[model samples]
Target: MTLVLDPLSPALLACLDHAYIDGQWLPVTGSERLPVIDPSRETVVAGLTGATGADLDRAVAAARRAFPAFAATSVAQRIAWLERIEALMQERAEALARMLTLEMGAAISHARAAHVPFAIAHVRAAIDVLAAYPFETLRGTTATVREPIGVCGLITPWNWPLYQITAKVAPALAAGCTIVLKPSELSPLNAIMFAQILHDAGLPAGVFNLVNGTGPEIGGAMASHPDIDMISITGSNRAGVLVAQAAAPTVKRVTQELGGKSPNVLLPDADFETVVASGVMTAFRNVGQSCSAPTRMIVPRDRLAQVEALAIAAVAQIRMGDPLDEGTVLGPIANQAQFNRVQEMIEAGIADGARLICGGLGRLEGLSQGFYARPTVFSGVTADMRIAQEEIFGPVLSIMAYDDVDEAVALANDTVYGLGGHVQSRDLEQARAVARRIRTGQVHINHPAWDAHAPFGGYKRSGNGREYGLPGFEDYLETKAIVGFA
Candidate 1:
């Protein structure tokens, strides 16, 4: 199919073909190129230059060169800069949303409603925190100061492309740290647009840079770069390990928000009619590609039949189709690799004796192309099963039955992951009590609205370091104690 570059302005379309480094739109000199596949259409929307060693080096050098001056900027100046970014993001929100929808598989509504606004919130939140943050505090005769952690290497995932980008970049910028961003090549278009957004926001040259390529080349170089004081990545556990291993040689700080097989424990007293369906919806949100998605639905064994019924009803309501459609609640898997993984996991669930409650391995009826998958729910899932233990990253939910609350808690904490989980109960105190025991970093009681500023990061093999609110802002800072400063 011919690349249709309509609707997007020439300037905006140009971003897809170039890499933004040191505030300049530069071409990738490498022979390798990656096609930006539109999951909605299963076609190449555009192609991006694969970052070569030279490209990574240029970006790192730019950030390193800008670090000293950028770090010296006043807190107020940083706040002002963030405010400008927020404004530009809002102004070009629709364009960015369209790019996100096309390059990724996010529904158009979701792209505008959740993806764009949530990302804008991160920048604003960083500004709010920085405005009141105490950068320096005195302890008797000593003073402790928080300073920018020099040039930061940020690698964000594709599931929530711009959202993850802003989550890391906003705080890093607010902390006065210069940065080089490497967004997932699968959804690199939005990141390119975001780079333009930062550049247009008047971010100083080299303050923010972007490189596009595979993990082995771009990610490895960023993680191992001697000048990159810290490496922050939001990717799979395997990818996180690679980044950590590479950064280990430099002994640089590393923060990762990796994979999760989080559980949604539906208490016995909880209204199954309301909570079960909501849990299914939550698990399947963003097509279940979220690292923190609650893919495991744990319930009292007696209520297994009722939970399965509710889940089927919920899955039935999901409209899987093109991301450009306003009614599409579920879109295609973001890439071919993920689609294959989801298919394999779904087939494995059936092979492992889990009852197929709603969806299974196949495309939705009438959708012959694109990477769409049926919203699947499985009952009679054992805690030890691969589907229950591993991260599916697709719209597949595993329903496990437990005899008692203790068993429920144990079931929820069974996996090595401790990213995010959901606990539903009629009694607030009971829910809170159960929430306290779950080993995950963030727990939702009765599916409360998402806290944009809440601290979000995992506790176990799910990865370390928080990524929201004050903790997120602090992640980009380094602390030093000065004796006799008082």
Candidate 2:
């Protein structure tokens, strides 16, 4: 199927005038530029105004100036503003969804349903959390207060642009903290649109700012800036480390949600045909770009062949082509580099003695122009294989057979990164029992609907901090004990 470019709404397009800094959209000191790409067709979608070190300084200074007043805003006032933003988001949901679909390569159906609805839910969740949060509590003579942390440097990734942005922004606003957002250069169109929603919602100028640029220039500047009190980032672990190193000198808070190599352990008694197929489907979803995708499937040795067969059948069913096709399950890898990376990993797996049960290299026939990758599956893989230890971040699944549940747990926890995991079993008690042994931050007994109210983070080198629920709101706040008798 040929790709169809989704047009952006006029109002959404108007937000690109300039970065919101110092109470207005100020032009940048540098004329560097970045272009958004539609990976499904390898086409340039939109051009975003890029920033320099000087441009970042301007945005940070504005955030610093607005901090005191913004942080002093009453909870009631913040709620009202959030309400307005929520309304605007719903009114413009289709346009925003189209932008997300085009820029991030999500199907329009998913963008409209999953992405947009989830973003709106995040907005509502923040308002709800703020309304009920125990911001002020008594610790005997000392009254504890959760105060806004100050100007926040929010850096989000390209995978789930709108979702990650709201996961940070909604909470930061709820905490009465101002922010300067540096969304991923690859998918900046919708983020720019979301910023406009806040602007049109009557938010005070300078309360929320956005600068578009690569990580080294804008993101590095924001993290190292002395005046910024906290930095919250959602991206790769490499990016997390860089942000932390940058924030160390200033002694500011650094919170990150990084990469993952999650596991999906299918118990012996579980229906291998059903669970294994579902596992393959989950790993292939979103073209397997999700941080928490169950890319590694662990099955009992006795059932290894059974699971592999099911996985192979599922991978064969994936339609790798245009994302716009309602029938297409596997879209192109996000870019040419990702395509090359997945191909290299496939070659590595084959070289390292892992058996290729299904796909191994190159694009699907007749669609070589795009960054398309065939849904890949490998079996006879040892947990220590490079593919199992590392994150391929593509629609590739590596199946490893285990002797017992203990071995499964050990293999799952062997990774340095622990972001998410999956436990599939026929018995509810057995699934719960397995979930306890997993070391990841969030685990799914099965493929459960994402709870808007759950905490999401990672352990080990996967980075720190949580997003969603009350815990997610806390990332943008600091604790203060105001001791006194009123």
Candidate 3:
């Protein structure tokens, strides 16, 4: 179905070709314009011109100019600004959520329920952190101060466009750091709406800027720019590596939230009927685009058949269709390239002798036009298999069986990624014990409610540093010790 934005404001649509710099919308300098496709129908909906190196220079300069004044603002003043941004976001929440569905093909319900609300929670989270944060403390005759880290370059991904944007932007604003944001070119319209929200909220000029372009062009420029104090990116492993390499010469602080092949371990004694169904849904959330999605399901060896049956039942219930449909549970893959990658991974699973319990390569039976992959489940998946080891970033689940608890932990930690993990058990202590043993940045016991306050990042090749809540807020600040202060 062709997606329509007839109800959207003209001003928001006008933001497509313009970059927000120093409180004004200026036409992008680059002549090359990239088409933004509506993944639901595989049609061009809008186009964005890339920001040139010169544009990056101007953005950096504006942020640098604003940093000193912004950084020196009173905590109360910054808090008030954050509150304003939060209120404006709430006022425009529906528009922001709809933009997400149009650009990234997220189900309207999912966009409204998880994407927008979770993003708003980050702003609220920043407000909470800023209210009580102690910027200065005394020790003997010395005073320790946490100050803003000048300017930050933020790069967000397309999978969770607005969610990832606010995850970094809100906290950085709260910490008093000026920003230059390069949102994913693939799904950038929501980001433009976000820029408008910040503008209307009365954010100081240069405090938050949005530039849309390719990773190689805009992202590369931001990383190597000397004026940028820190670079935080949420993207792929390859992209993270390139950013770190580019920023190495500047000696700037670089933080990344990259790829994951996170595992969901089902303790032998756990309620299989309940946990297996929930596990299948968690892995398939967002059409399985989440970096921290638990795509690997590790279960007891003997109950493999039972788990497989439960998984098949859950997959059958997922309703994949038009993202605009309120009842649709799953939407198309966010873009064409990702759709191709997912198909290849599913083919690899079959070729490697993994049992395809349900679903497989190609689009859902009737979804011939859009980028839709069948919700797939594979049994007899060994840890060494490519499907089990790689981050498919689609609705593909790999089920592996373990002989014991030690084996279960080993299976869960087998991959190079340590971004997120899940442990399920009726016994709270046992679940906690297993959670501790899983070598990931965050572990969820029995699929608990998402805590926006918890620090989120990675442990291994998944990338470094944290985002969300206090740690995320502090990541934008630097420490200084004033000796002889007393």
Best by lDDT: 3
* Candidate 2 pairs with clashing backbones: none
Task: Give the whole-model CA lDDT for all candidates, comma-separated.
Answer: 0.90, 0.85, 0.92
Question: Which residue pairs show backbone clashes in model 1?
Answer: none
After superposition on all C-alphas, the RMSD of every candidate to the true structure, in Å, is: 2.4, 3.2, 2.4
- Give TM per candidate: 0.98, 0.95, 0.98
Given candidate 3, what's the lDDT at residue 316?
A: 91
List the candidates ranked by TM-score, beginning with the highest. 3, 1, 2
Q: For model 2, what is the C-alpha lDDT against the true structure?
A: 0.85
Which model, 2 or 3, shows the larger TM-score? 3
lDDT tens per residue, model 1, 1-486: 112223355665666555678889887777677888988778987766787888888988999999999999998899888999999889889888888888778988888889999999999899989999999999899999999999999999999999999999999999999999999999987787778778877899999999888889899999999989999999999999999999998999999999999999999999999998899889998999898889999999999998888889888888889888889887889999999999999999999999997889888789999999889999999987899999999999999999999999999999999999899999999999999999999999999987779999998999999998899999999999999997
Regions more than 4 Å wrong, model 3: 1-8
Prediction 2 TM-score vs. true: 0.95
Stretches off by above 4 angstroms in model 1 are 1-8
